[model samples]
Target: MRLAHAHSVQQSGAYVRKFGAAALLLALCSSVGVIATSGTPATAAGDATSASRARTDELTLRTGQTLAKVKASIPSGSYAGAYVDPSSGTLRVLVTQQAKAPALDTRADAPLELVKARYSLAYLEQRMGEVFAAREKLNGKNSRIVSVDVDEAANSLQVAVDGPIDAALRGRITRLAPDTPLELVQGNSFAPQRYAGSRVDDFAPWSAGVFIYNKTTGGGCSSGPGVHVGSTKYMVTAAHCATATGQQFYQGHQDVPSVTPELVGTVANRSGYPNLDAMLVNGNTANTVYRSWYNFYTASSAPWESLTGQTVCTGGAYSGERCGLVIGQTNVCSDSLRSCGLTIATGPVNTVAAGEGDSGGPVYITAPGLRYSGIVTGPVNPANSITCLNYPSGLRSCSNAIVFTRIQNILAYFGASLN
Candidate 1:
């Protein structure tokens, strides 16, 4: 069956080898930017709208580029995070020393604000690692440390947990790192799970965040990219969502027994935390895999890329589309999934929070170019989650904290590219 799946990917279309659909689609979209593409829904961007989008796109790119310059211009361990403020359309860099921070300006003339932070990114990373290690020290000492994240916006390292951190744990954190600020939460902030919904016979028109069911068991997850290893194809999803390699996946929504879905792919687990989350769907390569942030029928989409402070969006079958800003990046650890494979730390982007069922969905940006940069690996539990786009009051909206595993890493792992 694996051999057959490989054959199907190689045979998805001969045209791809000669004139890949991806290349053709890029050309078509480029000639007239997708934000400006015709036949789009009425709400789609118009010519003027496209022009404005172009300007914002350029601004977002400039913000990131400028932030990079500022970041590099300063010595290491000087700043915590850089962000493009959506409201003010400004570039803000978190600095450990007010005077030592670089004084730079973006071409967009975006405002630059250097705010003092208690710790630099380098220090935070170093200490966060210690904090993670500290979790073991506090095993039964009464702290509910589910995961730890660097909250640059707040200039502190925020810890997510199933419950509160007692005085002893807080004291331990302070003693471990006197320079760092700390905050505690009492629940799984990023909960990725199957939401209740009816069945869909087939994902006729393929989309990145379409429904994917566990064929033998009874549940579903959203489909990720149609990734390939050499010619062997696979799909993407959260590791917590997939139990093992060859675990059957289908295009159905109903639970098992009530639904025996046609096999689309089996599990091909990627490098993901066994207990926490992340995974891949290996097969169904012959089928079209749409990597859109919105549309399911679009023939081509952007490749996976990454930039720290750019704006982006997320899409899941459960929650259609949610757009937000890029906060930064962090690595999360869990007491669950308790092994090397399960406990291994995952580098995840802190941005564009999505709700339940959005796990394994794509995190992307539209400016400079529309592309899928990473996969949603957060909102691991159903607690106070934010609805996609329904910000301020939705599930997993705290800090609008959606985490992602970079696509570049995923592609590199498989030694393959998108079809």
Candidate 2:
């Protein structure tokens, strides 16, 4: 429910029918590998080398050029180090230092090394500044602060607190350290939930790669990587996904297989799209069966309460199958727009992180194998910014939380049952 990070690209709303063959092929060809943390084994021999190596590879020189000048041709961060091969008229870039050196075959058409060096150096400096600023603000906090841990990969800070604090305290902490990934962990014992993978087959009836063709926009689309609900055959996704309005979902790397969605009879009656951005696809047939185990519900009713220390998770196209803790909720109503409630959940935000493609994805909480939560309606207003100050209230809107839609209302509107 938290607005962790905004999508840099604007929403096009352009729905295309063709499946992304290129993306699907890339996923199929690439090996499925877990991210190797700093201490983990290098998955491949080149892995370690690539990690430490400078990116600059080949640089060419006509005449009368010093090694530093040639090195400047490559980007600053391209390689950890470099050397000039005077005989070959090439500048060799060393990427990593391993027991065995990597092969650097320079060809005539190699690019200028300086370009890479300059860009990488600038990028590294910018990121370091952000990290340093976040740390300084956290150090000045006066509350009963518990512990502060830095997520190096995410470049954010996770702060644990003793108990619930007022909205004022939350705002101050966020304002003091705007760039840091500030997460408020409740009791000393409770740690935020980390992402554990899910099985595609367990959510039966709705196969992970099943695609639905949208007549509205004439496009084929699939559900993003999340639990799909309904009679095993039928699945649910954002109405945008079902409608294919520039919103397409992905499972791993492959696009969900497309089928002419059964629209009129059982399909039309059961399939639900509450508004312009929501949709449900029915896959129930004679042979296909729905699995109750896959579905879930929300904890609160419509117009939810922003209770501090409350925990929640959302299973959707972007956040994929991850869960996090909720830090803020707000009721937004206006003349043109009705009261659209928003809840913010936070953790490590990713790319398919949550975008137009993730609409209609389920946002639910699970206690191991027990009760499952429900689907998210939409993201919070002031849409994409991770941290924003509410002008009138002077409170920070989810500086530490992500926003989400209330699920119970959506479920009730569709007349669907959840366990």
TM-score of each: 0.43, 0.34
lDDT by candidate, in order shown? 0.47, 0.32
How much does candidate 1 score in TM-score?
0.43
Tens-digit lDDT track of model 1 for 1-419? 00000011233422111111111111112211121111111111221233333443344345545666677776667777865565676778888765454555444445677888777877776777787777767534444465665667777777655555677777877888786788876643222222232223434323466666565443345666666667676666665454346778776454334544567767765343432234567665422323332234321232534444556666554454566645343222222111011101112344335544555666655432235666665432223232333211222221244445555545533455665
| Candidate 2 accuracy as lDDT | 0.32
Model 1 clashes, total count: 27
**Per-residue alpha-carbon lDDT of candidate 2 for residues 53-140, written as tens digits (9 for 90 to 100):** 1111121111112333444444334533333343454444432222222222233233223211222323433443443345435333
- After superposing candidate 1, which stretches have Cα over 4 Å from the reference? 1-206, 255-260, 275-277, 286-302, 330-352, 380-383, 386-400
lDDT of 1 at 81: 83
